[model samples]
Target chain A: MPFFKITLIRSSIGLPKKTQGVLNALGLRKRMATVFKPVNPSTAGQIMKIKELVAVSEVEAAMTSAEMKALRKPDPGYYIETPGLG
Target chain B: MFGPFRATSPLSGGLLWKIPWRLSSPQKRRQRKRLRLVDNVVATVDAALKRQNMESGRNLVRWKEEMPTEEEMRPKDKYTMFDRKEKKYRKGIHKLPKWTRVSQRINPPGF
Candidate 1:
């Protein structure tokens, strides 16, 4: 199923309490926070409420938080080689 | 003072310790080869680290460029107030109607 990748791009500091609650329900605690939800009417409505504060994209698969972190991490390019003991 | 000439001790006066004879040619060659291999590994690791650093540095610069600035990141309603009691002009963002329909969802077209 397609997923909506919702990223909180702006703060909700002065927005209405209802809007803040919607953001909380969407699991967006701070700016740049990302959450994935199945593409559905309810999720779409929530995104619409905070459309000005977030960036949304459709993704094929929903990634876990750990996977997202790993994607952002830099690769370690080298491996150690050990001598064989005879 | 002297027992049978102890091969273990280089201090024994009668027999001189020969440097070249002790480690045979094959063992010396193997040690030299191992040292060269170690040097090559070190060079490879150094090069890899340099490349990684350069890539990371470029990524950092790009990230800075791509990230939204402070002005752009501020909440849309930051300058506006919800209350009408104040005399000053307040641009209320939440005063707008809540979106209930999926068709009302607004996002960048290409994102």
Candidate 2:
């Protein structure tokens, strides 16, 4: 199933209470917070309500929290060539 | 000056004095070689097994999909409560004139 990747890009400080509630329901509390939800009419309507404060993208699958953290980590450049004598 | 002087003179003569104190020439120290395990076959096999394990481990991680373009996700237009011409800004959206009116939307044109 396809998923919607919703990211809060702008602050909802001065927006209406209804808009803020939509953001809270979408699991977006602070700026740059991202959440994944299945593509459906309800989610689409919610995104339309606060379209000005978020960026939305359609993705194939959702990544777990651990996977996201591992993706962000940098790779170690060198590998062990020879084992030392124990 | 006759007997004792002649006997000691031969002891310090040219042939005997020309010889060196030591006989053999000094030998150079040899460089030490690094230690290597005797089992060459086992080491090469172990290295090959480790490389295969690493290649299989890389396949376990799934690839992520690409994100949408910026133009697709961008807001329609930039709207702010601050009016540059009047030098006044509204504290909240509820304070705006069109907050309660359904006919007049808060968003500007082309939004």
- TM-score for each of the candidates: 0.43, 0.43
Q: Could you give the DockQ of candidate 2?
A: 0.01
Off by over 4 Å in 2: A80-86, B1-111
Candidate 2 lDDT over A5-69, as tens digits, reads 77777788877799889999999999998888866555655665665566666667987768877
How displaced is residue B96 in candidate 2, in Å?
7.7
lDDT of each: 0.54, 0.48
Model 1 alpha-carbon drift over 4 Å, by segment: A82-86, B1-111
TM-score of chain A of 2: 0.86
Every model's DockQ, to 2 decimals?
0.02, 0.01
Name the weakest run of 10 consecutive residues (lDDT summed) in model 1 chain A: A39-48
Each candidate's interface RMSD: 22.0, 25.5
